[model samples]
Target: MPTALNRRSLSSLAVTAAAAALLAGGATAANAVPAAGGATAQHRACHVHALSDGRGAEVCRTWTPHGDGTYYGTWQVDRADANVIAQGRFDGKVRNLGVQGSYSRVKDFVTRACDSSGKRCSSWA
Candidate 1:
């Protein structure tokens, strides 16, 4: 026979374990590829437009997937001078027709520009 406190502790442990398992299953499901022509085919590569400082906006070229929807690309800004910006490897996903991902620059040129302008910016630096 166990005390009420012991039963409560066991119940709490069981609940925690169940929650962890559920979360792991959910993560696996999210990464799983759906049936072809069903939903996976509808997932497009993620893209981001070039940032403009109002002088003239830059044009971002199309990016192609490297592997498993991950992409690597580059964009050139031809405003004051020709500047090349490279986007490193990034993970892409599609959820309900919406594409999202995390992208980082291979270099710190963008952040340097922002910092020079005295504007607060977030970067890997």
Candidate 2:
């Protein structure tokens, strides 16, 4: 019993709703990626330096991956000829300060150190 104008409006509404539902379903199916628990891997790295007599020295460096968007590694430096351990975490590609409580935003640990300390350090990229 609707008017012709009302019928047209309802038809358009139904078409819009159908299109929206189709688009939503398509996006859900197409945008799916492997879960973090799956076979995907993530990696990150960083550098540590010890300063003595206003000079920075590299002690030790390493890079490791946990393959699930997490990483753990260690770096050592000699300040006054004593080893200083820097343990840190990498969230995918971002390095979080582990025991040192200092986060590095650089993609690689060594380049991150270069950006942080203004020194020529090796790259872990």
The candidate scoring highest on lDDT is 2
| Alpha-carbon lDDT, every model | 0.26, 0.30
In model 1, the runs with Cα more than 4 Å from the true position are 1-56, 80-115, 118-125
What C-alpha lDDT does candidate 2 achieve relative to the native structure?
Answer: 0.30
Q: Where does the lowest 10-residue lDDT sum fall in candidate 1?
A: 1-10
Backbone collision count in every prediction?
A: 0, 2
Tell me model 1's lDDT, rounded to 2 decimals.
0.26
How does each model score on TM-score? 0.25, 0.24
lDDT of 2 by residue, 8-125 (tens): 1222333444456567664221112223345322222222343333333332333233444333344433221223222222433434232333233322343122224333322232
> Model 1: clashing residue pairs?
none
- Which clashing pairs does model 2 show? 45-109, 46-109
